[model samples]
Every structure is written in C-alpha cells, then in structure tokens.
Target chain A: MVANIRDKAAIVGVANTAFSKDSGVSELSLAVQAIKGACDDAGIHPREIDGFATFTLDTNDEIEVARALGCGDLTFWGRSHYGGGAATGSLHQAVMAVATGMAECVAVFRALNGRSGHRYSQGVSGELLTADAIHWGWYTPYGLLTPASWTAMITQRWMHRTGVTKEAMFEVARCTREYAVSNPNAFFHGQPLDRDTYFNARMIADPLQLFDCCQESDGGSAIIVTTPQRARDLKQPVVTVKGVAQASAQGQEQMTSFYRDEISDVSEHRIAAGDCYEMSGLRPSDIDAAVIYDAFTPNVLLQLEAWDFCKFGEAGDFVLDGNLRPDGRLPTNTHGGQLSEAYIHGVNGLVEATRLVRGQSVNQPGKQVDHALVTSGVGIPTGGAILGKLD
Target chain B: MTPEEQKAFEDRIYAYVGVKVCERTAAKDAVNPAMIRHWAEAMGDTNPAYTDETWAANSRRGKTIAPPAMMYAWNQEGFTVTRGRASDPQTDMVELFNEYGFTGVLGTNVTQEYFKEVSPGDTLYLEMEIDSISERKATARGIGYFFETLATFSDQNGEKVGTQRFRVLKFIPQEQPTAATGDDKLEVPTRIPSPRGHDNGWWWQAVDEGKLLIQRCKRCQVLRHPPRPMCGECQSLEWDSIESGMEGEVISYTCLRHPAIPGYPKDPVCAVIKLAEGTNLVANIVGCDYDDVFIGMKLKGRIEQVDEKTTLPQFYPA
Candidate 1:
C-alpha cells in the first residue's frame, strides 16, 4: 500500500560542515560537528536522537559518533553499502525507525576527508590480487581495472545501444556545474564549467573526462528525521518523508557485472525508481526538484532516464533543454551535487533535498518546491527517497 | 623406513647440502605497461596488444592490454642465505647420493583476480612478506632428506598475488655407510662435474655480485635465453645484461613445472621473475630454493664475472 506523502515522518533539521578540499579535521570530528549542528538546528537535545544511519564506507563508527555527540541511547543504528548509493538508504532507515516508533527522532549523516585523507583515484595494486580480485584477473591482465575504466566499459556500450552522444553526457555536467555556481557550499561555487571545457577536459577513461567525474571533497552533513508532530515543534519547517525504496538486481557484483545480458540497462535502478514513484503516488511531473546522485556525470543522465523523467536515451536531450535548471522544469542539486558539492557519499544530497522543500536552497527554484526526489549510488544495490512539504 | 633410520639418513644428507637466505628491497615505480609488455614478450607470448599501442587502440579489445599472467614475469628483490651456499663438492655429491634423501617440493597455483586492466603507463609499488616456513622428512630415489620452505607473496598495497612451496633433496654418497636395509643393497655413483652453465654458476655469480641479470636481445631490445635462445620478442639473438638493483617485487610466481619439459624433475620449481628494471627473467631459482619463494619476495643480484671474458649474474634472497 502507498503511504501519504504529506503525513509521513518529517525532517526536523539539516546541518553540514563547510565543504572544502581539506577540512584539516578528522572524519570523527566532522561527524560529531554535523550531528551537534543538526541537533542544535532542530532545537532538540542530542540525547533525544535514538536512531542513526550512516554509510558503510564512513570511517566514523556509530559508537564513536554517539559517544562524541553524547547520544544517551541508540535504539537503532545501521549502515548502507554501495558508496554513493547509501545516501537515500540512510534516510530510508531513519524514516523506517520513526514510522515504526522505534525512535522519536533519527540522525543520519556521512562524513569524510575523501580528497586529502584517502584518495580512490589511484589505480589498483597487488593487494587486489586476492581470491575475490581474481575475477578481474581475466580482464585486468589486459589493462581494464580502475573504477572509471570499469564504468567506461558500460558507458560505451550504453551509448552504442542508445545512440546517446557525448554532448548529451555533457549536459548533465553543465547543469550540475550551473547549480554549483550559485551554491556557496558547493566546491565549484562561482566557477561553472562550460561545454567546451567539459569536452576539452582530460579523459580518465574513454568516455569519462575529469570534469565528467564527481568531485572529491572533505566535509560532513547530517539530517534530523522525526514524526510530523515532533517536526512541527522543531525550529525548521517540516519536510515529510514521502516515499523510499532500495533494490538490487539479479546479476549484481561489486564492479564487474559484465556478465549481465545488457550493459546499457540498469534495471535495478529503474526498479527502485518505480517503487519510489509508486509509493509516493507522485508522477515524475510532480517532483519540484531533485538531488540525483552524480557520482559520475553519465550516471546522472542515466538515472534521469531510469526514473522516467524522460524516455531512455532521451535524458541527454532533456538535460540539453535546461529542463533541470532552477528556472527551468525541475531544479536539481541546488546545493550542487557530488560533482560540485562535497561528496559525503550522497548524504549531503539528502540534506540538499530537505533544504529544497524548506525553501532554504541558495539556488531555490522560482516555484514553491513542494516535492523533491533523491537517489543513492547506481550500478549496485542502491536506494532512493521522495520528500514532500508537510501539510 | 623406520622413523629412527629416516632421521639418521636425513642427518647424513644435511652434512652435504647447504642453505642461503635472501634480503628484501622496496619496489616503487615497478608497474608500467611498456615494462610489463617487455616482460610478457620475453615469456614467448605473441599478443600484439601488449606492445603496439596503435594496434591495441584499433583492436576490438580497446586499448593495449597486459596478459594476466605477465605480473609474474619479473624477478623478486631480496636475499638471505638460508642453506647450502657453502657446501663443498664432496658434501654436495653426498647430498645427491642417497635416493631416500630427496624431499620433493611442489608449487601449486592458488587463485588470481584482476580488477583494473594493467597498461604500460601505470606505476606499481610492491612489498613482500614471508608468511611461513616448515620442514618435513622424505625419501627420494631410496635416499632420505630433510624439510623445505613455503613463502607467500604480497604486493606493495598489501595484496597477495602468489605463493611457493618448496623442498630439497639430500643423499649420502656411496662412501658413506648407510644403515643396513633387509635385502636392499644400494650402489652410489662417483661424482661427475656438472656442465658449466648447467650447474647454475651464472645465477650464483649474480647473487655474489649484488646484481640481477637477464639475457636480453641486443639487436631488438628484447629479453630471452633463460631456458633457450629463441627470442620471444623479435626472435633475434640472445644478448644479455646484468640487471641493476635488487628493487623489484614479485608480481606473480609459480612453484611447479608444466608437463611439457622432458626429463623435468618430478617436482621442479620455477618462477617468472619480474626484475626491478622492468624486465621479466625466468629461471630455476637456487640457494634457498624452498617453497617459500612467494609472489612478493624481494631478491637481490649476485654477479660472477666468469673467465675474464664473460660475466654472469644470478639472484638470491635479498
């Protein structure tokens, strides 16, 4: 059965540390700061937050975050895997906790020093030669092992089958950069990229240029989720949890799902999108804004297609038309995205969605943002959610 | 066959056979596509994608590709004299005399996985750690010998690539009296001089000189000539050079011989040695030739300039 979007659990607060290339702060410190900021923003004591959700890749443990924030007792604590895909999953867990009366108010956060602390851009090493890595032995010996390179394989095939041009991929980057230009918290604020710059950027993989990839930043973000009644008493305007869903397809593996029947198809993400739209009882047109996961620019485009914002292979054209701009049809990532904003594994994206519904986004759309869609990582078991203005 | 008799036979064999230990070195800037390709070509592979970038770009497989097994093509850096380095001919001959003294060593292939494809430009840092060593008693050719070693290979980023399990054969010479066996008489032959190169003299010299060496083709910049003279690269002449530095990590390694080599020892051990200088040298490692020669073991070179006219280099534990 579908849940009422306007009457579900609400977001009581949202907080984030200043995004920077080097925060000079430890991951644990960032997590604590965001959690404290969130509690303060919600006008609630830290002890009231009994539920927690975070990314699996986060180094900050729940116990550590809890102890630092002086959390009295945690009734629920969980982590979602698949890197950026965990963004909405965190919120999903929090909403589930609130809906079930497991916890009154839940805190979901992601903190990291991705750029300065541990960079994932470096190539593979002998450490990958384990029994698990042996699967790549079949292809790596032939030179195809980096994350971007692996994704490129699918991107190339997707373009081949769908006739999506490189220009179409650039539109996604262009829009995100435009949104980032106005977002003070975005890493690329005031420095939007152009199509020419995007095209001329250095290629990390065949189709993935440096600009096409997401930015790595050091920062933290947290959101407070509570019941609608509790949200009305909090300091910030309530943004109700509309709908959420997570899905993993049959042939899922880490990065090597090459054995799948079709490379261009992300049936898993499409399935999750369907569930999100169904449970929310909201059509694609009802969403006033979105915080689509942009770990890679092409993924954003692919996600648009998967979500039925447009037909498959038409996302490039949809983006090129400026339909996603703030003044256009649906503004996205008003605080920028992983591509421009700090990528705290997509948790920041959820925080942005909450801001949109609260009418607090720096790049706020011309219309009153009543609903927003947010997605987690792609190409893996992923999750998504829809947020709406509480009645 | 009795345990006491076996102990006595192994003790007599140990008096002859010796041991050597190798040290380790840091492997930085070891991963490169060109270097990997050079090593692969030397191993008798003809895949055009490894060498010709233009061909690779045009090929259906996309860019240039390194063979999965090519990581094991270089020599490891490190050395230690574990045993048998100082044995005289009498002791060595005695070690080979008793059939029951030969403890067999066998190298097994565990598992390997590749994530990103390795190309020519990628740089790899590698480190190796010795996992463990064990000794066992065995009888070979009616002679008895003691145990051997097993080693594991770990890459620079702390990934394990391969492992080696090895053992040594020791026999008492004919002159050495053996405990009587019921109705079983043994005859030991006189020690004959092993062929000059066949005795692995070149390898021993390289270890002594602190320089690893691989036979390379002077004409084509190709390396070959470990087991034979045909160039795997350009099929040209087999010229050789003393490889500089004991600073390469074992990308991959094997401890067993294939079924092809005729008269090959029942459990002969070999490794595809990726050298610090980006060349892959294949040879039957000696000195501490136990199953312990892991994938990431660091090895150094010992050079022996034979007969003022020719110089030979070999690798030992670094």
Candidate 2:
C-alpha cells in the first residue's frame, strides 16, 4: 500500500533569511531569494528543481516562484490549506513527488512579509473575504475577528481541562526569548525577557499575554528535497525524511470548532503525530531534539502534549520544568522558534529540524540531535515530520 | 533591580488594584442613527442594518442598529472632555508611572466582549477600574510598567452592555512610539448581530418588550431556545412563544479573553446554559468570579435592555 515511504527522500539543503518586522521587499522577491538560496545550498542547478510546494498563505504562486528560480516548467505543483497548519505539508508533497518518481528535485518554500505587508496583530483593514469569512460572520459580532480571538476561545477550554494557568504560558515566552537573546537572527536578539517582564507584558487576549503570542516577523525559508540516493551526492549532509504526515480531525474548523464535545482538543496534531510515529517507527523517546511550532505560547504546550512528548494536560509542567530548554529534556526550537525567531508559517522550525539532523544547529543540544520531531502550526488542521540522520 | 527594592516597589504599585478610578462617565453622545451612519461612512460599511432603513426593517433587527464594533464609539472621549481627569485612576496610574521615569505610554492591546446590540437612544455610561498593575521592567523601548484597566459600560438603568480591558505600556521609549506596524487609519470593525431574514423576528420583538419568550411547538408541546420555523420532533410549523422564569444550569462554558471584541468587554463568555425547560443557549455568567463558575451550578437568566434594538440574557448564580 506504500503506507510508509520511510527513507525514500532526504532534505539536502535548507536556508532562512534574517527574521525581521519589515523586509522592505515584495513577498515574490522573498520567495525567489529563499528558493535560489536553497538551490545554491544544495549545489543543484536551478533547472534540476521541477516541483514546487508551499502553504496557502504565501502571495507567490508555484508557477511564479518556479519561473523566477529559472527552474524550467514544473512537473508537480501543490499547496496545502489552513495557513500555518501546512508547514510540513510542503515537504510531504516534495517527499511524495520524489518517492513516487513523479519529480526528481522538489523545492519547498514559504515566503511572506507578514509584518510589513499583512500585519496580522494590528487587525485587517478591508472587508472580510474568503468563504471562511461567511463562517466567521456568525462569530464576528462577538468580536472574534483576529486569529488570536479564535484561539482565545479554544485556549479557555484547554486551560479548564488541563488546569494550566495563564502563568505557565509565560514560561514559553521567557525561555524562547532567553534563547533568542543569544541568537543574532532572532527579533528579540539582545533583548532578554525575564519571567517578571513576561508577566508584565499586557494581556492581548485572556490567557494569552503580549509575549504569549508570536512576533509577526517578515521572513522566508526554503528546503531542498530529493530521492535519498540522489541526496548522497548533495552539498550538505542528508537529513533523511524518516516520516511525514498531515491530518484533520472530524470536527476541524480552521480554529473555531466551538460545537464539539471536547472544545479543548487539538486532535489534528495528535493524528498527524501518530502518522509520523507509525511511518518512521520512531517513538517519542527516540527523538533527541524537537522543533515544536510556537506561533503562540500555549501552542508549544499543546503540540508537546499532542505529539505524546508529555502526558495530556501536563505540558505546562513539562515546559515549566525547563524540558524545552537547550540543556533540558528535549531542546526545542533551537532557532528560538516562531515565538522568538520568526513566524515563517512553521517552515523555520522545519529548517531547524533539518539543521539538527545535520548536526549543524547553532544552539545544538549538549547531546547531538540524531532524530528530531518537527511539528507544524498547531490548533488547526496540522502536519508534521520526523527528520533523522541518513543512516 | 534589587529584590527588596522591587518588592517595596511592587507593594506600592499593588495598592491601586481594584480601586474605582472613574466615576460613572456618560458617553458624550447617545446611540443615534446619525452616529451609526457616521460610523458606517468611516468604515465604508454597506451593511443594511447600519444604513438602509427599509432593508433593516425587513431584516431580523427590524430597524437600523449600531454595529457591535462601534460599541465603544458611543463611549469615546473623542475630541471632547474627560480625557483622564487628574484624580481619575487612569491619570493617577500614568502619573505613577511617570514618577518612575516611565513617562511614555502606548496601548499594548484591548479586549471587548459583546453581549447584546445597541441602537438609537441608548445612553451608555462607563465605569472604569484599575484591573492590574505589573512590576517595573526593562524593554528595548526602555523601562516600563504595564497597567490594565477594566471599563464596564451600562445604560441609565444599570444594565451592563459590555466591558473593555485596556492594557497599556508606560515606557520611556528609546525612540518615538515604535513606528506603528502599518496602522494606515483603519478603524477596527464594530460587530452587529447577523440578522438575516431569520424566521424568529417575533422572538426578538418580544425581547424588546422586556419579555423572555421561548418558542413552543403547538403540535408536540416542545420548547426551543432558538426559534426555528419547524419543530425538529413534530415537524410542526405552528408555534408560539411563552414567558418563563428564565432559569437554567451551567452545562459548559468558555472564557473569551480577547484583546478587543466589537462590543465592550463582557469578559469570559462565561457559560452555556441547559434551560429549566429544555434547549441550550449561550450567555455570560455574571454576579460572580468567572473562575468560580462550574458545571451543574444553578443559574438564573436576567434579561438586560441593551438598547432599543436588543435585549440580552445574562446569567447569574441562583
């Protein structure tokens, strides 16, 4: 059935632009820059890249990015829906294309001037578009406009179910910022965030403080993928795609599944995480480092629990106990995560996982990261990957 | 930065918690059709409920109503007076921050929770209180203190309409107010109830008359909270509304802690109710701490006259 395409493909190269609030360039330029950089890093001619993959949020289309990269006509072009939930989906498509002999070289990229172009935190200026707008029409009058508002609804229940206090989320901000202060690439570089400061940062949404949410950074990231046999001759170490999966629960609504029995459930990520584990034959204990998505502070906790890294309703304590630290149980988001690094739609976390698999991460855990679990954006339809050293 | 010094400092800042800052300040203008039109023009909103009288009359709202997003417009101190009096909690808090070299102030975020609709002639009165004050901290901007204020808006009859949670950072910025991340004069939207040609216009009409009406199916004698045209059990089209004591129990709930909702901060959507008769409805749990609310708790529904267009059901511990 080809249910598990284990070790069929490997990530040969990855590149990320400096994360920032304003890039002062078009999203198209960002995509081209990242794609070209990845191709160069992979030592692959632009023409060798025939497939294009990315999420729905990016402004640039596959045809435009492919054309811009001078990567002749594309044979495979696909995108995943649900904003950041499709972070690993681009890689999943790349893997499927290469494994099935549909395409030789696939370039997975995500580029968006989130801050300069579509500042999500400031709220939208125009009329609501998209068919989802009609569904949102039912809740907008209640003030559920921004993504944070939708998350706030779920977070409320998650808190009630888990007994996880708002205080526990602050630790995520502080820890990620602590790592970010050390990395020059982080928006909070040189800006240390202590627990008290994190607490003092005003609440944007209930349970979610200002720092609890991720920075709306403008950035682009790309990963190069090909058949594991072909990747043997690539420029960088082969970070074999051990497993990849995407999933959605029965009652999944982008972020608002308010009518469900368990409103606190992030079952989509759990379902995706299960697929990754089943396909890779790697348990949670087999993972050395993880790059859990941190679009919001609580998202990390939810992903940690959803992926079975910690018990359900116990991620808050796992995080508070310093488990996600560089020296802790599992060094997570060593690139400072979307919370501190950048929100490139969770692609940056995948880049970090690739780096970990290559043993080239800037903040490499004291113990080398042989296997890393890279999760996409949580709290919605989600996807994930288990990246490991090419054995 | 010393712990002892920080302790003393925090102790002093903590003294202002829960203090009533602003005496009831009336909105400069009562909700009126002209004000609604002005808001619609500013927003380029073409919603018939906000502008067209004929369309709104035929719609579920029965008449033009103010947008929930514009809930704060009525209470805005805009270009007029009451821009934080000297003794007001807001002014005092700012002054307190200034004394600590945190002379600059910028809004971090704001959250509103809307419960009901507001329309013409609804005079809004706002009461402000110091929700919380954080310990001093250093940032890229400079040293700062974040203080949050909760403002409750009600009408002349003291029926709460909404609440607003405003969090502001009083900082000595390194530069001018961190160049607003692309704030190109876009007014945040005010939400109004989506009144499509809903089949239950009579129910809303009854609410306007200060009555809590539940639709009853004549064929099978079953009551429904949301008035649907046909009964699910009997497939009956004939139905009538009957007034009940408006009592229920807390079944499930969510606390909506959003920065800014269209209306005022009704904070924590509170609870979903399983009514005394039958059927479920969502409403806020008031008159008690939100954290204290639990499933199976006895609750009684209190309908508040939010405006000429809306009467909202709010639940309190029975």
For this target, which candidate reaches the highest lDDT against the unseen true structure? 2
lDDT at B35, model 2: 84
List fnat, each candidate: 0.00, 0.25
- What would the per-residue lDDT of candidate 1 be over residues B1-318, giving only the tens digit for each residue? 597975675476454333322333334445566566567668877778787778888988777866656544433432433543455343344345435534332232222334445555443333232222223422224333323333333455545545443433343323333555456543222111122343244643554455555556667875432323556557765556656564554433333221111112222333345667665543334456545666567876555432223333435677
lDDT of 2 by residue, A147-176 (tens): 675676567668877899976787778778
Q: Cα deviation of B11 in candidate 2 (Å)?
A: 29
Top TM-score hit: 2
What is the lDDT for A385 in model 2?
A: 93
Which portions of model 2 show Cα errors greater than 4 Å?
A: A122-126, B1-189, B192-258, B261-318
Segments in model 1 whose C-alpha atoms lie over 4 Å from true places: A1-6, A123-142, B1-318
True contacts kept of 2: 0.25
Interface RMSD of each: 18.5, 4.3
Each candidate's TM vs. the true structure?
0.56, 0.68
- Candidate 2 achieves a global lDDT of 0.77
